[model samples]
Target: MRTIDRRPLALAGCLFLAALCLAPQTAHAHLVQTGFGTFYDGVAHLFITPPDLLVAIGLGLLAGLCGAAASRSVVFALPAAWLAGEMAGAFFPSSLALPWLTTVSFGAVGVLVALNANLPRALLVALACGAGLLHGFVNGSTMVAAGTDRLGMIGASVSVFLVITLASGLVVSLRAHWAQVAVRVAGSWIAAIGLLMLGWLVRGQG
Candidate 1:
C-alpha cells in the first residue's frame, strides 16, 4: 500500500486563510492623513491592501517550497531590495510603467509556486529582489508627494519583512504532501488574479 500526501491540501488551505485574514483594500495612491501618520501609515498600508499583501505572501510561500536556503534568501533579499527601490523612487522621478512591474512579479511567482518548481538558489534570490523592488517603488512613489518618504519607507519595509517571514515560516514548517498540494492550488489562484490584472492593464493601454 502507498501512503497519500495530504500536506499539499492542508498547505492550500493555510495559504487561503492567510490571504483572507491579513488582506483588505486600501487607498495606495494617497497617504492616509488621520491616525498615527507617516511610519505607522506605511505599515497600515501593507496590511490593508489585498494585492500587495497577496503577492508578498505568494513570494514567501514559493520560497518555503524551495526549502530553508531559499527562505533565508528571500528574507535577506526582499526587504533590502524593497528599501533600495523606495529610496530610488523618493529621490528620482516616478515612472508610469512601474506599477505594472508588480503584476509581473505576482504572475511569475504564482506560476513558480503552482508548478512546485525547484529553481536554482541564485535565480530565486534575483526574483525575490526584483519583486521587492517593484513593491517598494510603488510604496515610495505614493508617499513621496506627502514628504513622509523616510518614515513611510521604514514602516513599509519592516511590515513587509515581517509578513513574508511569518508566511514562509508557516509554509516551510509543514512537511506533508497534502500541504504542498494546497500551496500549489493557492499559487494558481494568485496567478489567476495576476492574469486578470494584466488584462486590465492591457485594456487600459489600448
Candidate 2:
C-alpha cells in the first residue's frame, strides 16, 4: 500500500479546528438581532413567533367579523394592554411558563371567529386585552432574560398595532358573503393548528 500524505490531512484538520475556534457563539433562540437596534429586533420578533402571530390574527379576524367598531377597539386596546403587561412582567420577573395559555387563547379566539359569533364590543375588547396581557408577560420575561432593552417591548407593541390594523381592516372591508365565509374558513384552520400543537404538547409531556 502506498504511504498516505500525512501533511495534507494534518493541514485540513488544523484548518477545521481554526474555523471552529473562529465561529461565532450561539445567540438566544427567542431574540432576533436585526443589526438595527433592540427595537427593530422586537418588531421582528412578533412576526417570527408563531403563537403570538396566530393570536393576533385570530383576534383581528374576530374583530373584523364583528364590524368596524370592534376592529377599531381591538386595534388600540390589544397593544395598550400588551405594553401594560410587559411593564408589569419586567418589574416582577417570573419563572412560570404557561405555553398552554397561548394555545388555549388562540384556539378559543379561532372558535369564536369560525362561529361568526356576534360578540359585543366590550367582550371583544376584553378578549383582546386578556390575550395581550398573557402574551405580553411572556414576551417581557423573555426579553428580560435575554437582557434586551425595554424599547424592544415598545417596538413589539407597535408591531401588534400594525398587524391588527391591517388584518382587521381587510376583513372589515369585505362585503360578499362568500368572502366572509372565507375568513371563517381561515379561522377554522387556525383552530386546527392550535389543536395540533396542543396534541403535540400533550404527547411530549406524556
Candidate 3:
C-alpha cells in the first residue's frame, strides 16, 4: 500500500483561500446581481456577489473553528433563519442599514474566527441565526426589488445553506496544524477587509 503525501495539497488550498480573502472589494458596490428571474438565478446571484460570497466564507470559517457541534448548529440555524428573514423581507423591503449591518457582521465573525473562539454551542447557534437573518434579509430585499418571486427566494436560501455548509466542511476537514493556521490567517485577512470596508463607508458618509 502506498500513502500519498497530502500536505502540499492542503497548503495549496490554504493559499488559495487566503488569496481570496485578501482580494480587493468595492465599498459601495451592490451586493446582489440581477439573475434570470428564475430559481437558478437565485443560485447564480449568490455566487456572483462578492460581499455575499465573503460573508458565507466568514460564517463557515467561524463555525469550523468552533468544531463539529457548532458546525451542525450553523448548518441548521443559517438556512432556517435566512428563510424567516426572506419571508419578512418579501413583505417589508426597504433597508438603509444593510451596509452597516453587513460590515459589522463581517468584522465580528472574522474576529471570532481569527481568535479561534470556542464559544458554547448555543452561542454559536445564536450568532449563526442572527447573521443568517441579516444576510437573508439583504438578499431577499434585493431579489424582491429585482421582481423575483418566492420560488426565487427559496432557491437563494438553498444556495446560501449549501455554500456555508461546504465551506465549513472544507475547513473542519483540515486536520493538520498548518491547515488550521491557514484558516486563521484567512480569518485575519477577512477581518482586515471588513475594517477597510467600514472605513470606506465612514469616509463616504462624512
Candidate 4:
C-alpha cells in the first residue's frame, strides 16, 4: 500500500496560515470603540488622537503657567467650548477638512509654553476656548462621518476636563525651577513635532 503523502498536507497548511496572516483588518479612522459605549469611545479618541491630545496638553501647560486662577477658567471653559463646537459641527457638518488648523493650534500653544509667557487671564481663557472650538469642530465633523453620536463628543469633553484639571494642577503644584524648565522643554519638543507635521502636510499637498 502506498503511504499517504504528508508533505502536501504540510504545504497546504503553511499556505493557509500565510493567507490568514496576510488578510486585511478593518480600521476605524475616526471613532475608537471600547465596547463600553460611545462615551468611552469619545474619551479614548481624545487620548489616541495626536493633534487633539497635544493641543489639550499644551493648553493645560499654558494655563498652569499663567496661574491657578487661569487654570480654573480653562478647565471649565475649554470643555464647554468644545461641547458647543461639537454641537455646531454635528448640526452643520462641513465637507471641508482643515488639518492645518490642528497643527497650528498645538504649535502656537507649544511655543507659548516654551516661552513661559506671562499671558493675562483673559488671553489664556481665550486661547483655551479657541483651541477647544476649533478642535471640537473637526472632531464633530469626523464623528458624524463615522456615525458616532453626540454622546461621544460629550465624553470627549469630559475627558478634556479631567486632563486639563490634572495637568494644570500638577504644573501649579510644582515649586522647583528645574521642574518648570522641564515642562518648557516638553513644550519645545511638542512645537518641533508640530513643525514636522506641518512640513509633512505641505509635502503631501505638494
Candidate 5:
C-alpha cells in the first residue's frame, strides 16, 4: 500500500462526512421517489428531456467520481456498471426476488473491483453489464406496475447513463498521473457514498 499524505486523506474524510450528512436531504435529483423501489409505480417518467439528460449526466459523473473516491480506480466504473447491471435485469420478470439479486450482484462485483481495480477497461464493461441487469429489473418492474412500456424506457435510461458513465470514465482514464493512488483515494469516497445508499435502502425496506 502506497502511503500518501494524511492531510489529503483527512480532507477527503471530512468531505465524505459532509456528504453523508447531507445525502439524505439531497439524493433525489429529478427522479421522484415513490417510496422504495419495490413500491414504485411502473410508469415513472425518467425526465429524458435535455434538462433531465443533463441532470443524468451530471449525476452519472458524480457517481463515478464518488466510486473512484471510494474504492480506487475500480470505483470509477461502479456507477455505470451498477446501472447497467440493474437495468439489464429488468428485461426478465422482476419481483421482490430482484432486490436480493441486485444486492448480491453489486457485492460480488464490488469485491472483484476492490481486488483488481486496475484491470483493463474491457472488464469494466462487463461490470457495467451486471449493473445494468439489476437496473433493468427494477425499471421493468416499475413500468409493469404503472402499465408502461418497460423495454423502451429501460433502453432510453440505459443509453443515457451509459453515455454519461463512459464520458466520466474517459476523463478519469486520461488523467493518468498517479492513477493508482487516484483510484484508491476515489474508491474510498465512492464506498462511503455506497454505504449511505445501502443504509437508506435498508431503512426503506424496514
Candidate 6:
C-alpha cells in the first residue's frame, strides 16, 4: 500500500530555493547586532548583528519550530528558547551566568529534553535548544556590551528574546496540521539559517 508521505524533503530543494528568494529580505533584518547598534553586518553565507526585540521573539518561535520538527512538540521549544536566552543574558560580563536564570534555563532545557522529547522530539529539541542558546546568548552579550546606558542594555536584551519568540512562533503557528514533513522542513531550514548566522558572526569578527 502506498503510504502518505509526510515529508516536504522531497521538495526541500524547491523550498530552500524559495526561501533563498526571500532571504535577501531577511538578511536585511538579522539576529546579530552590528556596530554600535547601527549596521547590517552582512556576509555572503552568514548574518549577525545586534537585533531588535522583534528578532528575539522570532527566535523563540524558531525554537518552537525546531522542537516541533524534532518531536512534533512546538509547545516545548518556545519556552526553551526564552529560558535559554534569558539565562544566557544573566551571564553577561562573566564566564558564569546569573546563577538563578542560568540554572533555570539549563534546567528547563534539560527537563524538556528528558520529558518532552521522544524519538524525533529528542533530537529536534536538542538541536534547536543548542542553536537557540548560542544565538540568544550572543545577542544578549552584544546588548550588554553595546548600549551606553543600563536601561538601553536591558531594552536590547528584551528586544532579542521578544522578537525571536514572536517571529518564530508566528511562523510555526501558521502551519497548524502538524505535518511531519512540514515541521521537519522548518527545522532543517531554521538550522541552516543558524549556520548562516554563525558564519556571519565569524566573518564580522574576522
User: Which sections of candidate 2 miss by over 4 Å?
Assistant: 1-29
Per-residue lDDT of candidate 3, residues 34-136 (tens digit) = 4455687777777886566777888888888888778988987888898888788778975433676677787888888889888888998888888888777
lDDT of 1 by residue, 1-206 (tens): 99999999999998885554333233246666547878898888787766668778888999899888889988878888888888887887363334455676788789999999887888988988888887777777766865675988888888889988997898899889999899999999999888888677656541
Colliding residue pairs in candidate 3: none
Query: Lowest summed-lDDT stretch of 10 residues in model 1?
Result: 19-28
Model 2 lDDT tens row, 1-206: 99888998999998885554333322234888899999998899899888889999889999999999889899999999988887877888665445667777898998898999989999999999999998888788777877778899999999999998999999999999999999999999989988887787666540
Q: Model 4, 1-206: lDDT tens per residue?
A: 99998999999998885554333322235688799999999999898888889988998998898889999999999999998888887898765446667787899899999999979999888888898998888788778878889999999999999888898999999899999999899899889988988787767640
TM-score of each: 0.80, 0.84, 0.80, 0.84, 0.43, 0.35
> Which runs in model 1 stand beyond 4 Å of their true positions?
1-28, 95-97
lDDT of every model, 2 decimals: 0.78, 0.85, 0.77, 0.84, 0.44, 0.41
Clashes of each: 15, 0, 0, 0, 46, 37
Judging by lDDT against the true structure, name the best candidate.
2
Cα RMSD to native, each candidate? 12.5, 16.4, 14.7, 17.0, 12.8, 14.3
Per TM-score, what order, best first? 4, 2, 1, 3, 5, 6
Model 3 TM-score on a 0 to 1 scale? 0.80
Q: Which stretches of candidate 3 lie over 4 Å from their true place?
A: 1-37, 95-97
Ten-residue segment with the worst summed lDDT in candidate 3? Answer: 22-31
Mind giving the per-residue lDDT tens digits that candidate 5 earns over 98-193?
A: 333344344444344334344444555455544554445455454544444444454445454555556456545545656644544443444444
**1 or 5: which has the higher TM-score?**
1
Alpha-carbon deviation at 112 in model 3, angstroms: 0.7
